[model samples]
Target: MNGTNKGGAAPGRGGGLASPRFAAVMASQALSLLGMEILQFVLPLHLLNLTGSGALYGGVIAAGFVPYTLLAPIGGVIADRTRKRGVMIAVDAVLAIAMAAYLFAAGTSAVIAATVAVLMLAFAAQALYQPCVQSAIPHLVESHEVERAVALVNQVGMLTGIGGPVAGGIAFGFLGLAPIVFISAACFAASALVVAALVHVPYEPPARTAGAVATARADLKEALAFLRSRPLMWRTIMAATLVNLFGSSFFNVCSPYIVTETLGLPNQLMGVLQGALAVGGLAGGAIVAAVPGTLGIRRVPALLLGVVAGIAAIACVLMVPLPALGTYTALVILYLPTMAVCMCMSIVATSYLQVESPGTLVGKVMALAIMLANCVTPAGQLAYGVALDIVPAWAIALVAASVTAAVAWWLARAER
Candidate 1:
């Protein structure tokens, strides 16, 4: 499937960040992710204001992930078959148009429905878009630089994420949703241009003997057969799935509720915490990029244990008698490091998968692995959403920590 490289060296043998094509892809992703992250932060706040129901807020968030989970495998097929640059350019353009259309419809009675619909579309696009990007990484960089490239990719999103929520919150606070939507649309539009003009992905036509549907099925079966032979990959996927369920989903659902409702913090502070989450990810990606081999798959269990400790600490913080600002401060301090650990674990798992899979199978294999790991996230979101209504934040934290601890245990046993 490899083609002669343009504006860079051949696939998997040359080009680090110095390559023009690699830099262009990074730039495009940065803009696209900035837009997406801004909306990601803004939408929940909008829904929370409109409904004031944790269950509804959580449901809307989970609804977005539903399509993401379902469409990921299809995305893998598209990525493996088509030109990645075209896919990136097209998806960003579509997202820009969707946001622009939604801007005008914001004043209508259909605002809530429109919001959910637009968000789901965005999430769906992300499911289709990301596999192309992830699969392309190995093709763009030398084999040894794959981890750094992956870290760089993760960092771009995390970097934008750090500013997106804070900027979105401030914009929403003062200018309302229209301006944020406009900015997001502009960012996506810019991303499309960047990818179309500069990003270069080596491509070769995939051979097909059957119809499209049959081909897709066969491709998926090939991927599954490959995975079935790799028990370590399955174990890794299982451990990652548990972490996503208990660790990430808990914060995703509980953070807004705890910050806004339980702690009575302002909307702006919520934005800060969200940005802090990104900061953690940014830091984690930096660590991996700087020292790619320092933390290997063997260390993942310890990282998961670190996440357990972080969640348990959150429970203790909630139990403490502190002022609202103090509690918020404690959370930011605690969450930043904890999220960094989670990010490291995620990068390690992804880097391992990328290294293990062959280039031809990378897209489908990554998609399947990611789908299995991510499939539980929506369920966890919904479960925690409902749990927040009846359970204390402290108790929920403790339970989440306990569940994640079990996952860590399983991971350690498997690794041993």
Candidate 2:
């Protein structure tokens, strides 16, 4: 029953990122991520070109978040109550089936509706799937390898990000959307199969003498109570929410709008710009893996400050009238530090979460934190949509950055 023989990982001090189970998970993750990154790039670009409206683009992106946010707590409970592998396997399989929506999106009829539906479907699966994966981290390795495991998983994502966007752009441009959609489906199916083969992590429903509803309520209440006791939890959640609030526009509307509409660049050029963010992620993951605790949890505010400054700089360049390729290169350059810091901060926080929570409640706790934080995101994204119509993208980015800096400072002070 050892993880090594069954593609499971070893436990205790010997366990690290090198374990077979983690290795298998990473391989499966890579396959799904490759397809996902492609669709992520394609979906927005398809919407932008189809509608030619920045507001509509942002609105579509914003709509997809509602379901994911709503499903987070429910998903977390499901992850805790059921076998983690089953939750992951089922969700990935469902997502694979959902990828078919893209083929329908190729045609022009009801493109906005189709876009929103597909986005919702993908997010819904992610809402259920993400916590299971995060929760699985502790079970996969020894206590010590938590940070390294998080970084390695993140590194897998960035690896795909590096290739997925570029491949997506080229694939979408030359081959169009059909083949890309099929590839995405196959990748998700592969991910499900890989997870299906993973050794089961230990999980048992908490003993409760009460009824099912009472048990669910008590379980949720405990996760909330635990969250309330930890100042770091709230601080981290606020900081992340602020990032999503102020930063969503950069990807949701600003980058695409500036690259395709403002700068008059080809859709394929977006690959180069997005690939820059992934490049930063790749580097960040390496550093985080090597020196996991280099940046303390308390200093996350300082990191957030750097992100705000980066966004401000990005806003400035967005207004400059540069040639298409030059502009793409400039945005890519600006995004590097921002993405790098964000990726590192993400690793640090995720590690902190793992260290602090017990395996029994980690899934629910993390999911609730994420869910609460995301509540504000839809509003921010939607407001950004309205702002896109009223103001230049520069002003929106600049203002969002400033507000984010203020929020980050507040979190630091509050935590102190």
RMSD of 1: 3.1
209-318, model 2: which lDDT tens digit per residue?
Answer: 98767777888898889878977776788778877777755565577777777777877787777788899888888988888667767778888888888888988887
The stretch of ten residues in a row with the least summed lDDT in candidate 2 is 1-10
Query: Each model's C-alpha lDDT?
Result: 0.86, 0.78
Clash number for every model?
A: 0, 1
In TM-score terms, candidate 1 sits at: 0.96
Clash count, candidate 1: 0
Write candidate 1's Cα lDDT for 112-162 as tens digits.
888889889999999888999888887888877778888889999898988
Best-fitting candidate, scored by lDDT: 1
